[model samples]
Target: MKLPLHERIRSEIETAILSGTLRPGARLPTEHELMQRYDCSRMTVNKALSALAVAGLVDRNKRAGSSVAQPKVHSMVLDIPDLEQEVVRRGQRYRFQLSGREVKQPDPDYPEELQLAGNSDLLRLEGVHFADDRPLACERRLISLAAVPDIAAQMFDKISPGAWLLEHVPWTEAETRIAAVAADRTIAARLELPIGSACLSIERRTWRGADGITLVHQHFVGTAYDLVARFGPAKGSTGAEPQQL
Candidate 1:
């Protein structure tokens, strides 16, 4: 299906802002530039920019033109965590050991595995994070090849996938889910814990605009690990968005 011209323009700009290419308060392209780029009428470009203003993603000024808007709220927020930083910040040494790596389609035979990039082929990885030479977390991740082609060449031997991605990728949005669960046999052996020991399980997904980037699951020994983050409120968050926990 063909997208409307104004929608396409809006999506392109939104993707830039979300991916950090267009930071807050950055000047947007002039109407003349947009018209020349998209080969559209001024009205079409104006419609697209107006939609962005309404959504609070941009601020329009008659004299200064349009610029990316400031965040809408100041409430506390939690963010996707980097396990290596978590350990190193506590004055412990950190290392990652890769157990498996493959390029495969989404959805394997194992129901326990998850890949949320729809039909995109994924760079699947499995590894363990060690803090001061003790197993700290077991990680299973799927990177969307469509979204980050450069990742396929990474050797991940000297770094964890999460850390590498944090440095190299720009993500628009992310979702995290937390659960307390009994360690399954696979995770128990990997983390060197008795089966059924309590563990903290976190599953996170990140994206660049509409294209999915990566989904990862990290499991930690509940007695030994903690996840923490500091953040400001999400842009345009309101009573409409989910409450912060």
Candidate 2:
């Protein structure tokens, strides 16, 4: 099936932005220029640009034209979810069972900086979060053994690593990223979803003082969870208010 003309235009620009061809702060083509390039009407070009602006991928300026948006630094200071507590609050039984654990020394193949593997061993863990005997999320976590040596000895029989870390460790800084993805064979099997099923992925990292503590990536069925981030603009930035749909 062929996409609409406006959709095709949007996809082209979107691919450029994601592929780093159109970098952040880079000026995009003018509305008139896009109309000429796509051989579409001004309304079609405007529609494509409007959609990109709504997705936080571009900043539109009527007089100066459009440009790629800078990445957001603030995450609204919202409460990060501990799946166990979240499930229980929903009046359901919460359980976390570890399926795999290993102490790994990460190489350059991975994002070494975030893994905190330069001088420390990373305790890699794979697990699933359950609610009332149903799979809720799949997790892959890496704990810096150097930052929290005690985590090496703690056997997570009845508690999850995330919950345990939250209780025992104090973080000075943290970051979170949310993305949509299609479930692959591994994630599909773990979440009991069909291949290509839409999924939501949350990746987070925390640091204690100057040292990195842990990094975790979790995947949830798209229909099973809602991530609401209600935040205003940062103190000095002219960015728009952010909301997750």
Candidate 3:
């Protein structure tokens, strides 16, 4: 099966944006120019750009033409089931570069950062996550060893810890906090990004059953990634506004 022409074109543009060749607010070529460049009809160019616009990659307007939108801060409130299904449907080859694992007591070095107690049984793991061969994210996770025993024997080489646990264990709930942060030296090196680059940091905790706290995951996202949501009213329309905090 081959990719549709328009999808291929859209992917090309997306790659350019991720690689920083198409900076924020940079105007994309006109339909005529794209037709010439891709050797396709106006319909093909229009379809390609339209798909990009729908995906929040570009802003297209009759008067303003088409240009890259400034990258948005993402808030992905994903239903876990849907995310798992989507990943399976994509049939993408995945890989993980396991950094290391440590057994230690928790610390309060970054209090504002996920606040785990200092005396808690901590098992820390670090790695770079990949989709196919592309570096997707730098992951640093801390698991409560007392909560999930035998975690040290589990190998994350063939599957992500998150996905693996989701399949093998039953989780009741998860809480997450997302924020923007600048990449540090270690992350920059791992993600092949420049130092001080903007990245999204997500902290999450998952609970198993009623009393078991399973894991804590921290994801550092690179450019071209976003968390999206479908918005609607919480109840009947009134003076209330959408709450984001």
Steric clash pairs (candidate 3): 74-227
- TM-score of predicted structure 3: 0.52
Judging by TM-score against the true structure, name the best candidate. 1
Of candidate 3, the 10-residue stretch with the lowest lDDT total is 236-245
Query: How close is every model to the real structure, measured as TM-score?
Result: 0.68, 0.62, 0.52
* Whole-model lDDT per candidate: 0.78, 0.77, 0.62
Instruction: Provide the lDDT at 96 for model 3.
Output: 73
> Tens-digit lDDT track for model 1 on 1-245?
34689978987897788666898899999999999999999999999998788767789999999999886643343555566766776777889999999998766774323445455678999999887888888988888886677788899888788888877665656777889999999999999999999999888888654567888888887888655554445433211111111
By TM-score rank, best first, the candidates go 1, 2, 3
- Model 3 C-alpha RMSD vs. true structure (Å) is 19.5
How far residue 39's Cα lies from its native spot in candidate 3, in Å, is 72
Residue 110 lDDT (model 1): 47
Predicted candidate 2 versus true structure: per-residue lDDT over 1-245, tens digit per residue: 35679867876887787556888899999988888988889999999888778767789988889999886654334445566776776777878889999997875677854457548788999999887777788999999988777888878989999999867665535777889999999999999899999989889988643568888999988877877555554322122111121
